[model samples]
Each structure stands twice: as structure tokens, then as C-alpha cells.
Target: MIVGIDLGTTNSAVAIWRDGAASLIPNSLGDVLTPSAVSMTEDGTILVGVAARDRQSTHPALTATAFKRLMGAQKPVMLGRTRFSAEELSALVLRSLKADAEAYLGEPVESAVITVPAYFNDRQRKATRRAGELAGLRVERLLNEPTAAALAHGIHQREDKEPFLVFDLGGGTFDVSIVEIFDGIIEVRASAGDNRLGGEDFNDVMVELVRGQLKGVDALPLSNSELREIMRAAAERTRRGLTEADTAPFSLVWKGREIRRDVRADAFAEAAAGLIARLREPVLRSMRDSGIRTEQLSEVILVGGATRMPIVRRAVTRMFGRFPNASIDPDHAVAMGAAVQAGLKARDSALEEIRLTDVCPFTLGVDTVEFDRLGRMHSGVFCPIIERNTVIPASRVHVFSTVRDNQPVVEFGVYQGEARQVDANVKLGQLSIPVPPRPAGTVRIDCRFSYDVSGLLEVDLTIPETGASKQLVICDDADAPDDAAIAARREVLAALKVHPREDAANAATLARAERCYEAFLGERRDHIGQMIIGFEGVLQKQDPKQIKEARDEIERQLDALEGERFL
Candidate 1:
């Protein structure tokens, strides 16, 4: 059976359409949510999800989290002794989700529909698909996250038709999609987002607060990685705490002393003014692109876990002069809607009459020559073909001729963005098709771009006079790995042993205690240290009952010191 997965930046989840409704698939621990974190032990054993996340502060060097932001950068992230590409790291998360789905369904699952931020460029989308491939799943579709959330929202509404907006602020990405539904048909009018803006960026604002407010913080012995992860965890907790209370303590230990500050909601809002401002552009752009005014929207729907924050909700309220809808669970909407999409792909009888259409989030075009004010030919000009927000599956064609007489070849540098210059846009790929030598205007070539439902692009070029033709698939050279490389990475991942599931709770508890030990001071620090020692001693005893008892007690003690329930 095909499943739908939200391969999120901070957390991931999977769901399937069963009994005519979408249901979340639980993992081994009976939790539907999985933290998107990966860690490598000293013995080369891998740990994912909560176990790895708990290790972030304790074993900062060995753990990697929030790697989704680097998806299309083709950069390597070091996890212990190994260097993993963002694709490889994402594949591990996907693999874990796949296992959970299989376990829940009691059957082997192979195909999936994965959701991505609509603002992701061609390279990022392709990288996501590659990640799915590496995890042994045939990616049926790469659904836009906001669009998916829209589907989930539309499904539960009683109205036959309505227009709405989806505001998605995920862990590492933000997207806004304008949607309209009419008589079982869902159409996305426009999409806009910043792949770099999200909840994690807010965490950065909190980190900056610590650096600026805490004395001698700049002189601390923390490495860039350690400081970031450590402060991010603390800031995240404080930020969440502020959601329910006006003030929350942001504290950490340095040497033998405790440093603390009360973070006020008003202060955080003031410091994050720039980020709140950044959120305005996308909503305005989506509204403008869709030709819909704020008042025209029947409801503004909030999606993604980040939207639960009061600050974000207030921003949306101020923008629209109305309270946004939060009827759907922000965290589960995308994955659930993706499951609905998986059902649509399968032509499920229950959804046979429903139709969904989505827009291309960015403009796709090619480089061309344009005459400047002085009549001088300027190359590297961007000539748009498929405009952003054009509904897909879509195809558009444009004709062009050589700029120079007797030009031997016609080259097209495919790009995606809103820039007027090709260099300012993202280059998807380049294509060269041989043309018959002739005067500048004598040879005419037609370039046709076809964008499919799954968000892949195909370019077809044909010269009318000579019938010469060429085809180019949109993919970045550096971002697209060859089959051999994929196989090699798969082998590398398969060879590593995974930390035993039975011991995950104990490990997580110990890791959390270590993190607390680092964050506490004086007596509390000493107490956590002794607790860690006691847990290790229990593990060495090799008695399950004794270890479980010790682990539970230590977790309770850390919870009290951490005030985790308050957060």
C-alpha cells in the first residue's frame, strides 16, 4: 500500500487512507510523531528520532538535526566519523518512517507521496525525490506542504465551495498557498515562501538574545555547533513556554555557575520584528498573485507546528484583521492530506470524483538575448515560459532565433525564479541543440516546457526548418547523484547497525540527564551527574527491571529540574 509522509525539518510523520479516512501510522513506541534527528554512536551504531534528538546536547558532535534546510546545497554534514550528504540524512529519516508504516500496516510498503515546501526550487525538489529513492520507496508524488494542508482543511469543511489561504511555518521553511475549492475540485491559485525562514530562525533570534544579554557569553568555550544546538534546545523550550505564559526563563550553566534571564513575550516579539515582517511579503505576494484581496479569503488556515505560537497567530490576525482558523491540527494536517493525495493517486473509489490542481510555485524560463536602450544585444536575459502560479500539469511554448548570423549552436540555460536576468535566477539545467547555419532571423526554434503533476519539468526544443530537436530534464548537476553513488551510499547505510529499540528509552533518559547536567549549576549539576553515573551502573548490571526502575526515576528527576511539563 502507498503511504504519505511529511519529511519535515524538525519532525516527520506518516499516514495512510484507510476506511475512507486518513489515519496516522504509529511508530514502534506508539507515537505518531518522530523527531527528524540522526546520531552515530562511537561503535558505529545509528540512532534516529527521539533517541538521536535527546543526544543533541549531550553528544552534540555525533548528532545531526535540522539538516533539511541544506537539502539542495549539496553540502556534507559530519556525524561522528562519517560525512553524509543532506539527501543521505533525509533518506535515513524516510527509512525510519517507512519502517513504522510497514509495522503499522503489517505489510511491505514501497511507494509514498512526500510533502515539501512549495517555495523549494527545482534542485531541492529533486533532492527530496532522490532521498525517497535511497530509502527504497518509489516516490509517487512530491506534494506541496501548504497545498496538502489545504486538502486536509477542505476535506473537513461543510461548505461546497470557498477560497482560503494556507499559512505554513514549519521547522525550517515557510509557505503560503492560496486555495479555492468548488464542487469537489480543489485548485491552488498561488504559492510563496522562504525556504530559509521558519521556527528554527526564531530559535536563532533566541540564541542572539542569549549572546547579547548573557555576560561573557562570547568568551565561552562552546564551539559553533555546540553553542547552536545547546542554545537552540533551551530557546525552543523557553519559546514554547512563552506560548502559554508571558515570561519564561532562558538559562544555562557555564563552568560552575548558572546564568539566567527572564524572556518576556513582548521582548521576544520586539527582537523578532524583522522575522515577523518577513512573513508579510509571502502572504501579500500570494494574495496579489492570486488576484484575491485579504477580505476575499473566506478563511485563513494555519498549518505546521510553528503556527501554534501566539506570536505567529497574532501576526496573521493583524494581517487579515481576523482570527485565522486552527480547526485542523497544525502538525498532522500535511501528512494526513498527503494520505488523501495518495488515495487520489490510487483512484480510490471513495475519492474517485474529487479532483485537485496545484500551481507551479516559481517561474520557469530560459536565457535569451534582448536589445538594450542603445540597440546593443544583451545576452543572459530571462525569457519566461511557464509563469509562477500557473496551474499544472502545464505546458507552454515560445519561439526564438539566433542572435548572431550563422550561429552553429543554440544554447538554452533553463532557470527558475522571478529575476529579469538569467544570472539572478536558479539555473535548473542547460541544453544545446545544433542548428543549421543561417542569418540571425532565418532559423526559428520552438522551446516547449512541460511541467508534470509531480513537480518535475521537461524541456523540448525543435527547429522547424531542420527538424533538429533536443530534450532537457530539469536537474542541477551537483544535486543529482548517479545511480552508482546512490547504491554505494545505500550499502554504507545498510552495513551500519541500528541501536537496539529495546534500549532506546534508557538511552534517551541518560542523554536527557546529561543535557540537564550541562544546563544546571552547583547542586543540581552535581545531582544530575550522580544520576547519570547511577544509570550507567544500572546498565552495566544487565538487569532489565533494575535498569527500568532507575531510568524512570532519573527521567522524573530530570523532568522536575527541566520543568519539561511546563514547556
Candidate 2:
């Protein structure tokens, strides 16, 4: 069976092509959305999805969520007795989803079309594919998340004659794509986004607000664990509230006092001003690169949960001079698109025969040496192989020669990104073209870069004169640690007495949470003076056991307090 998976940062969902239609497979909880969280049990078993997320309030450290942000990062995180590289952690999540799909279909599932953010660079894209392999599944193709959403939209409106933009703001990333559909073909003219921005930032802002309210009181002593649980729950509530209400109220009792604060819609908007502003450049750049003006785009399709905020909707409308099309649920559209792609892959659907053309989000180049006036070799010259916005499933070639006499090898260090300076871009990897012992500029090495629909790049280096060559599958970087090293690292990580399962980790995570809360309190001391007075009253019961219980109760109140802005 072939399936489509949206392995989101905060949550994930899987869909399959069946009965000539796309269907989503719900997790054990009967919910389509599964939190991208993982929890390890005392027996070394791993629990994924909603179960892991449910444990987060109690076991914050053991439960790893939002690891997607760390994709391509050189660092690995230690969890419990197990240390997991970013790819392994992602595999755990994907494996869980695959299990759910297989059970639903009563058949073994093999290949899949996974969706990724449109702006993911080569390293990140490669990491995603590796994750799929680690999960024991073959990735048929890597579809851009926004492109999938566009496919779903286009399928729904096969008769509509208008160009649309897909604005996807997921849990940990945001991407805006401009797509045009004509004669059953979906062409992505341009795409852009910030991998670091998403719904998590909004929650962090609310968490800070609540921390300030507690800090205003001069007499309250709050534990870090207590503050974090309160803030996390509060941030979640605030995020939900902003979806509908004009004002949301958050109230909590710390020590023996009652604390309350109402976060108005306007305040929520103000808090997210910086994040919202960041979206402008990407949207404008996508449009500008596509050569499509606001007037030319017939509709804007919002995809992802973050777009549910009225503030976001209004900002998009103001920018495009038209309200976005919200007929399709933002959260489900990407998965639906993924399913559609699966159907196409399976060749089992009658949906209009459509071909999608995507582009590399970043530039592809090589690092070369240049001579200075002093005749020193400087190695920062970047010769681009494929420029950004070029059609995908495309390849480009560049020719270079050895600068020194009798140089037996020409080393080409490949890079990705639009930055002119080598330090400003991602050094993907390198390929060395072996040449015969020849004098300066005597050998011609042809370097070719081929990018597929999955956004994976492959480089082929050929010594055309001698017919000697070397090829590299871009996703397979030879220098990256192999499975053995990664496994050894994981074993070492597991033995570090990492924080315990859900509830135990929660305590330590709460401490970190409290530090963040206190920092917020110090910054916003003036606005929450009254709330602080009440917050301290509840914290005076200092018995450890009682404090723990009271802290949980108080955190619930904070959750309610932050829930006001959207609901």
C-alpha cells in the first residue's frame, strides 16, 4: 500500500489512496492529528503520538517534540538512557504513523509520498529522506507541503479558473507558495518561508505574559516546575482562544492569592506583530520571483493551523487585497494533498491527470579557488550550478580546471543557498574529480547537478577528456556518521540517567519553564503588579509534596488564563 504522510513538527498525520479516493488513518485515539512526541518507558519501549504528548505535562524532558526544527543540525539530543540523532527521533514518529496505516489497511505498506516544507534546503531535505529510511519505509517521493495543499485545492476546484497562493504556517515552520493551475497542470512559480517561525512562538509569548503576572508580587516563591506547567498549559489555551474570542482571560492562584489577567485580541495581535511582520518578506519575494502581482493572484489558500488566527487572515488579506479561501480545513489540506499524490503514484485514481513542477528553494553551487594579487589561493569563489527558481527534475553543468601543475585531483566543494559568501550558505558536501597529472588549466572537469521532484540533489563529476567520472547521490553525504556511529551514540545517550518518563521529566522541565517565566516577570514587572500579589498567596504552602500538587492545580488555572485571547 502507498500512503502520504505529513510529518509535521508539532503533529503528524497519514493518509492512503484507497477505493479511488484519499482517506486519512486516525491514530489510536481516533484523532487524525497525532502529536509528534515520543516517550520512553522504564522497560525501554517507546510510545509515540498522542500518548507521548499527553505525558509531556508530567514528563517534559523525556518526551521529545518539535525535533523537526533540529533537522540537519550537527547536534544530537540525549533522551533518557537513549541518545537520538534528529533523524532517529523523526524515524520513531514516522514508524508509529506507518504502524497505524498498516493496521488500518490490513496490509503491509512499503512506499510513501512524504510532504516537506517548501523552503527546506538540501541538507534538511536529505535528513527527511534518511528519516523515512530509518523508519523502515521506502520514500517514493518527497512532495512539498504547500504543493500538496495546492493539489488538493486544484482537485477540489477542477473547473475554477484562477491562480492561488498557498500560505502554510505549520507548528514549527512557515511557507508561502504561489501556484498556477492550467489544463490539469500545477506549476509552482515560487516558494519561500522561515523554518524557525510557527505556532510555538505564539505560545511562548503567552507563557511569558503569565510569568510576568506571577512575578509582580514581591512575596511569592514559585518553583520552576510549577511555572513551566502553568505556562505551557496557558500558552496552549491562549493559542486556541485567539481563534475566535476578542479577549481571553487567564487566572491562577499562587500561594493563597487569586491572580487573573485578560489577554485581549488586540494584545494577542501585538504580541505576534514581529512574527507576522516576518511573513511579509517571504510572501512578497515569492510573488516577485513568480512575477505575479497581488492583482494577478485570484485567491490565497491558507494551509496549516497557525493561519486560523484572525490576525493572520487579516494580514494576508491586507497584503493580497483579498480574503483567502478557507473552504478547506488548513490542517487537513496538506495531508489530503499527500493522499492525492499517493493516488497518482499508485496510478489508481481518475482525478484529472495533473503534473506538478517544483523548484529548488535554494541556490546550488561549488566552492572554487581564486588567485589574489599576491598570488595566494583563496577558496571562496562560488560558481553556481543551478540558480534558484529554476524548474525541478532539472540539471545544470559547470566546468572548471585545476589551477596547479601536476595536480592529480580537482576537489569541488558543493554548496546550497543564495548567499554569495561561503560562510553564509550550507556546505552540502564535496566531490573530487580525479584527473591525470597535467599542467595548470590542462584538464576540464564537468560538474553537473540534478534535482528531482523530491528536492534531492545528485552531483556527477566527469573528466570529459579522459571519460573518468564520479557521481554522488546528494542525499547520501559520505562524511555524515553512519548507522553504527549513530547507534553507538544513541546507546551512550541512553545511559546518561536522562530525566525519567513523563511526570518526572515534567518536574525538571518545569524548572526550566519557571526560569523562563521569571525572566518574563522581570521584563514585564509593571503590568502585572496586582496579579502578582494574589499569585504569591498560593505559593506560601512550601511543603514539597503539597507544593507539587498545588503547582499542578495552579498550572491548570494558568492554562485557563491564557485560553482567553482566541476563544
Please tell me which predicted candidate would have the highest lDDT against the true structure.
Answer: 1
* lDDT, candidate 2, 1-567, per-residue tens: 889999898888999867766678986545688778776756665667655665555556566778999987877866676677788888878877887787778899898888999888777777887788767778888888999999888878875456679999988999988888888888888889899999888777776655565555623333555445545655776667767799876654444445667788887788778988998999988987888888888888999988888898999889888888989988888988999998888887486477778877888899888888999988887778888777787889988899999998888778988877777888878778779998898889988999877555789999878999998776633444687865664465344332323333233223323322332343333323433444345446545565556556544544453321111
Off by over 4 Å in 1: 216-224, 475-479, 537-550, 565-567
What lDDT, from 0 to 1, does candidate 1 have?
0.86
CA lDDT for candidate 2: 0.75
Residue-by-residue lDDT tens digits, candidate 1, 280-337: 9998899889999988889899998889888999999999999999989999999999
Which has the greatest TM-score?
Answer: 1
As a TM-score, model 2 comes out at 0.80
Q: What is the C-alpha lDDT of each candidate?
A: 0.86, 0.75
Candidate 2: segments with Cα more than 4 A from true spot: 41-45, 160-162, 218-226, 252-259, 371-377, 401-408, 434-444, 462-470, 476-567
**Worst 10-residue lDDT window, candidate 2:** 500-509
TM-score against truth, every candidate: 0.94, 0.80
